[model samples]
Target: MENNLKNRREFLKEMSVFAGATTFLASIPWMKAFAGSDGSAMAPSDRVRIGVVGVGDRGRALLMNMQQIENVEIIAVCDNYEPNYKRAIELTAGKAKAFYDHREMLEMKDLDGVIVATPLHEHAHVVVDFLKAGIHVFCEKSMARTLEDSKWMVDVQKETGKILQIGHQRLFNPVYLNALDRVRAGEIGQITQVRAYWHRNSNWRRAVPSPELERKINWRLYTEYSAGLMTELASHQVQVANWFLDKIPTRVMGSGSICYWNDGREVYDHVALVYDYDNGVKCLYDSMIANKHYGLEEQIQGDKGTIEPEINRIYSENPPAAPGIRQLLHSIEKGIFETIPIGGASWVPETAVPYRGQIIAPYDNNDTFLQLVGYVQAIRNGKPWKNLLREGYHATVAALLGLQAMDTNQILEWPAEYVMEKDL
Candidate 1:
């Protein structure tokens, strides 16, 4: 019995020592995946190798964010424009290999994922190519320049077993996340309407040395390269409305004009849209480059209260306080000699009173970085990504519907074919 007991004690001690050593080694960044005794290099199962396409302004920002995430490496970058390609290399500290063509970059065996930030028109081709190559994709918002392109991207995404994360950063924003939680918790009961607007005062003009450069740098001003205020600015609010309502708009109508900044651009400088959902909820969105007055980015008006997701303000209307005390005080101060009706007889029923309710402050984080982190983590873990192709397509379609309604001077019903065809 004593001999058997001694052997059991020895076995337990050895196991404990082995477990401790394994954990200690795992805690070390350099030895994160190894059993230390063998002195072999650790291979990370969670690290995502990323390639960047269209290293323009937004693409460079995405690349910078990706650089800050752990377990992710930027292996390659591609851009058609030479200036953008050079800028991307500078931004990445020249750590990634540069390519003039995206197809070549997609062929890099080391890339586990890619971020597509090309011009609005090129989004579909780039995204579809990367998806079909079995690489996860993070495409910028307004998924494509046209509805057909948006649909095609969705179909390709379904066919490919790769993650497709759209760049609607608000979907991952902490403020929106908390606001969604509060709305779902019934803090603001039955959201019936939403008001959203973005206003900016600018010339809405671009400086281009040549016509070729004009097409490149001033893409937002031309209809051929962009969808004007609807896709560029209103898409964000439309997405917020859809997220909060948990449904796509059933119908859309709006009007837009180039009343200001008449620089011969093909798109509008101001737009207003109304989205009607099947649930009877409505979202009002507007974007104007001629003014800066604004109420809020997005305000959800519910039965009980209102929630401003962008400002992180939530509150219910406060009930008026009784005016009897104020009237009594006024009567006393009047000394009864004036015969002024200052008491309850003269009191007004509706008086403003300070009411305090739940107020949540907005969250502070590099949302761009957080979004990239989620994308990289999902890619490495083989998990589903948020803001998939369908969401992007729907948002784009909604924006385009507003644009069409504006141009035609008619209320546009959501087209049946809008939801049907694939590829733009």
Candidate 2:
């Protein structure tokens, strides 16, 4: 644990130099939120008491990450499902109190914060309850299953004046941090377009132990609980696009269908969307469960270069040693003055070529753990990171908008009712 802290400090220091800012860390939203009034770090002795609302897969993962940080205590765990409840209690080594109802856990006076990992449909309800109870919250991404509910969550957070950090872990990643800095520095020049996709070949389902538990265990396949690929996968990529572009799209259009997995799933298995931003920049997105060849990627394209942040590589539009150099070498070797063309016929044209990119960030850190630590720090400091919360809010609204556009088969503009007054 000591070594991990040391390495993180060194990595942040190095990235600060790379970003050409002496106060790069201080400029980050989470960092600013966690900093004291005098710009000092929080004392390690200030312990934070936290509870877990849903102890399923993602919730259990957060519990595991929480155990690694110091000066933090898991005071309570809640889940209605017996198996998950038992597993969570076991993970806590029986030290934390157990509850089947989240409302009961909210009665604990000492609980400072809660990690809400319930299904998408329950996010608005559970998160609203916690915020109204005067507890800071770290809820999973996409905010809620519906746009109105998502907006309500944000409004309640404002009314309560409590910290609400949505689960957009990429915002805390070192590689993404460096990439954002580069994009801001014009390394990629004016952003022309962005392309992102998430693909898988498997039927997105879970093994149900009993027939009645199908809805409980496989909630992601039902529209009542999930928005399928759009909210589950595209939300993250669209958040990335918004963060790097520093602007939100004015409108969205898309189409979706249950093309491959037709096992009575309520949501689409395939979706393709186009988000039109200001300055005529567009973000293209697609996902399907029929093929895994392309896997997943968020490709940010600009006039000068392209960045694939998932792979941590950047490709230049015009790489050094092009047709001029290569053709000269070929002509000299062949003892001819005629100009020699590169690969493929000149008239054939090509969409892509082999251009190995440079690595952006080489060091890897556990962003999940870092995000968990940030949440704890924010709780201890008693302040909310509005910028971070707004990023998640915009992404969730964009995804839900895409779903609406697909369902109605019409181009949809950002709704006036959902827009925050501060944004206007």
Candidate 3:
């Protein structure tokens, strides 16, 4: 018990430093920051207690990930819907308190942090409350549904020094990190273009048991609540694009329509977008709910090679020779770039696989779990992850800008407000 009291004091001291004042929040020992360094076994007294708001599909997934982390305790779970609320409580094995309203959950006073996994449109409101309470927040992308709301979240995070980690799981994926390292090391040569796509065959709707639940259930199809494919899916690829390019787009143009799924959905079922960076790099992106052929991919192309982190492959435009005497012997055996003509009829075109690639790293990269662990660690240490908030905001604004272009039928200029955060 004495150890618990000392832990509480240390936690408050850390938090007071964050708030720029010594006034501590409720001194519940459960709110103590984990005393262990990275990967250390945290006793219950040393665990960072967290509250989760909006236990929907994504929220529940995040909750499950949190349960896998031994150093974190989910002291509270919040959801407006009864089914989600019950499922989340069951997942917690009834160890957590349940609240229909997130605000009530915030009143618990023992929470060191909160995860805001509400719909994109609902992010700003829920996240702002957590920030105001001096609670660290992990908000899922695309930061918020609107530009104003996204900016508000960023601004509040700046005002309060609490850790604000937006969920862009690709930022933590080892495949992506290795690819990025290679790119930075000029393994892919000069990056010239990037192409990404997300394809699905479903209408992206929920089966509403009652007509009244239509708007609530299929919020992604509604313009008021969601931006459909762009915000829901493209947000991931767009973020990866920006991170690789190391800059935000200077301008954006796009077109989207519900040409296939004309089921009274306000948002588009297909979208084609192009983002132009000031450095003359272009990112080509497209998505469709009418086709599942490609599934989803982000292809980064450069002069010497191409990287597809999705498949953990890097294809060299020119495969270098094997080192030492074997390479010299192989070169002596065959003429460079000369095709042996005996394999197929001259009139018939025979296709042999042209490009060869090697897997740089072969680990089952669990991106979502990495993202959660990052948030927990940052919160436990009382520090924010560097530039994480800006990554989410940049992508959200880019998507919004593209939507404007699609709506206006003209290229839209990127907003200067984003320039404050984006180094570009």
Candidate 4:
């Protein structure tokens, strides 16, 4: 037993070091200043007791981040898979109780919140159950598999008045937050269009482990457990577009195909979507699996400027014109010297500028930790959660609509009664 405990501690230490390295490399300039030596400004005694459900890939990552935050405790962990359950126990250094069923974990009176990292399809059911149990939830995104399920989660959240923060980590990313502020502040002028794409080379192939474990590990490739690229990848971009536009998409149209990998996977390997907002703005998005040369990119193009959140690039179409002696000489010797376009109505040159925007709440790469901190802080301060349940519902709905558009080969419209739908 002592040896087991020692090994668990060693595993946690290794995981912590790995997470720290990733967090360091992916660090955002704005977030670094906000992350103190001991994480944020929260008191250690006020730590939120957390129970994590579904200890899969994302679940383990969340566990590592939670460990870094000072005012947070992993009280319990639940996973149906025995290996994952054991792994979660090891990851938490045996500090958290383990359970096969999430319901059993939720029954623990000490837990102040829960992190739902279950498969996409089970998101709504598990989140609603925990919310109804009067426990705060931080569920991973694409919140649900279907539109009906997403709406249902929203309704239950409203009824329970519990904090339901969906895990769209990008929403809390410092760079994205900075871009959003610039968009909202009109630095990018009127956002006429958004272009986003995520491309990857090679078939999204995984080892086939005895048919049973096939669905267990790579649930993403199957429709039963996941919604493929549309939900897994495009959902993040859709949420960002929504946040920038400050409105949900009115209509969605798209298509997808399984051109690259023919591994008996039900979901498409590539997908593209066009979301039309009520204000006439549009978001064009595409994801491909055959080639990733372009990698992942998102550009918010406006009349005045463009912002690329991923690259941290911001540029203005209107640049300051040259003046004084240079302008005078060019005007005098038109034949000898070529006329340069200056900042005027007729000629505008795109020029990159330092991003001077600020995020509403600065996020570092440790956003997951910051979000957990925020949730715990809100609970301790008796304040409402900054990330509301409706946001998660909307993000999920948009993702599901994108999938529907692809499947039905028609534009999917958001129903008026979407908010009132009951969870399945």
Candidate 5:
């Protein structure tokens, strides 16, 4: 444990230096908050008091990650669900106060920030209230179930001038940070295409203790509570595409159907979407619950190489020569220019390169942990990272638009109503 802590401190020190670089900060402006003005790690005395709402799966995960960071206190937890509330209290080891209603917890005056990991439909309402109350927020992704709600949340944050960080962990991930550096440095050349997908065989449901708790326990499988695969899963990958390309889709087209998991679920079991960006860049996305093969991946392809962030691999367009070719080159350099008969297969099929590729980034701690730390840092500094909300907003709008396109069987243009003239 001590060794891990030491490594984490060292890694954070290195990242602080990396984040302080002018070129890297210019490209990823949000990372500027990662470094202190004095170029030192956040002091342990800079403690942050935190509250968590909707203490379910994602909320618990965030709690666990937050606890790992020094000087962070889980002051309070709120949940309407009994099981989750109990679990959260236990997870905090009884250190945090528990409340059935978020409003009651909001009455507490010491919260530096609140994490909203509520269901899709609850995000806007819960987050807006907290922001209006002058508390910083770290809401889970997709912003909200509806575009209007999502936009309204962004507006509320702007009005309040409090930190509103959408839970896009990749934004704080070292692997993705390194990949972004390479992308900006033209290591992969100009990005030509982007593709991302998530696949799993499970029904995407929780085991309900009773029939009465079905709706509350497994809200993800229903349309009234969630957009299912698109908002919950695709939104994360879509955000990655937006961040990497630094462009949101101007238009999107797609299709979806409940081909599998036909057990009374209101949402699609599979979906395929195509998002069109400026300069003819396209992001093709799809997700399915019938198969787990091809799992989750976001492939950013450029003229020179391809980056798969999930697996931390970069495949170059040009690979090194074989041993025989190198030997031939060696011979030629020594003045052995004998002509050899070129005999090979008449039809050589072109395929993906055999090279497994190189690791794109160094091993690091959990991205969620890093992101939580950034949130606290932003709170301490009283400065919101530029365009961070914009990234979340664009991705949420794109995902909702993709669902609209899929349902209507037509291409959907980006809605002008939600487009921000400037970053908030």
Candidate 6:
């Protein structure tokens, strides 16, 4: 009995600190990760009780994943929208209490933590109050709608000493982890540029059941609730660039226009941004709702090789030599000049793979579930990740900087206040 319980505890601890926690699970496409550990679940009384606020699309998905964990019980769900509330409670099979007002749900003293999936603007209040209530909080990314609120989150977490984790699943992704390891190891020669994009073909508008709910349903399309593509899409890659380069962007410039989707939307349909780092490296990002041709990607380019992390492939500029036997035969047959025969087709260097190339990891990367697994485990241990706060804060500020640059039509330097701890 003691051994069994000890093993379970060990596994739970592993779940918390396993960098690229799901790399192995993601590589095994045939297997499903129902829960992270193999040992028996903790007794009901010993389980971690959690609540979820704002059961919108992202929130509901988090609840669904949270429900699958073995010893974590979702105690409550709060969503102002009836449909979203209905959907979330149904996932809990009505075992979890439903509330329209988050204030009421936070009153549960026994709740160990809560997932704050509220709209961008609502985050500061929802998260801060939960922190004050002494509940570990897992808030969704784009920390807050404005810069001051975003920084306040980090400050409050430090002051309160509560577990605060931001939802940027890729930080726990195995593919990115392995790629990050390689980049730092000089796998790709000195890093030069990072390019990222997320493009889709849709008007980006939600159906308004009534005229009153137009802005509420599609909060992502308005400046009041969101920063559009910068917040919605580019934020992920911005963090990746920062992580890979080990520095925040020193300055940023951007532009946008409502090119295709003219459906009474305040945010732009197309956007472009360039963020420069001090070391002559730059992170280039662009997004458009008008085209689906270029789906999404974060491509990191170094002098010797390029890693298209989204697809997991690494391409090389200088390939390795072929097998000695094959090389000997080819050298003899082609007279050692490495030349094309007369009257033959064009001769070209071999592709990247036939020499120095590989997938960052041998798997399809699905990291969201693993990230949540880490969060639940963190709550159990009463300690959160050190980098999660910074990942969420800096990336968000970078996105807001892009928005400011676009709005003002000028290159914006990284704020001096933010630059105090680190060189810009």
**Which number leads on TM-score?**
5
Tens-digit lDDT track of model 4 for 59-174:
99887777665567888999998888999999988988989888776677878888899988888889988988888888888788988788788778778877777777765555
* Clashes per model (N, Cα, C within 3 A): 5, 0, 0, 1, 0, 0
Best by lDDT: 5
As a whole number from 0 to 100, the lDDT of residue 378 in candidate 5 is: 82
Candidate 5 ranges beyond 4 A from true positions:
1-4, 25-27, 36-45, 322-354, 421-424
Candidate 2 regions off by >4 Å? 1-25, 32-45, 322-355, 421-424
After superposition, candidate 3 runs with Cα above 4 Å error: 1-38, 43-45, 321-356, 420-424
Cα lDDT of candidate 4 equals 0.73
Kindly indicate the candidate among 2 and 3 with the higher lDDT: 2
- Give the alpha-carbon lDDT of every model: 0.73, 0.85, 0.79, 0.73, 0.85, 0.80
lDDT of 2 by residue, 126-170 (tens): 999999999999998889999989999999998999988888888
lDDT of 5 by residue, 1-424 (tens): 6676676677777777767655775457667655644223456667789999988989999988887766789999999898899999999999999988888766788888999999989999999989888889999997999988998998898898988999988888878888888898899999999999999999888999999888888899888888889998999999999888988789999999999899999999999999999789999999999999899999999999999999999988987665556667777899887663333433568657555999887667488878887887788777787778887788789888898899889998897888865453
Clashes of 3: 0
Candidate 6 local lDDT, 123-181, one digit each (tens) = 98899999988899999998888888888887888889898888888887767877877
Superposed Cα deviation of residue 355, candidate 1 (Å): 7.7
Candidate 1 TM-score, true structure as reference: 0.78
Q: Candidate 1 lDDT, tens digit per residue, 332-365?
A: 8876543434355454475464445444543453
Each candidate: RMSD: 12.7, 5.8, 9.6, 8.4, 5.1, 6.6
| All candidates: TM-score | 0.78, 0.87, 0.83, 0.80, 0.90, 0.84
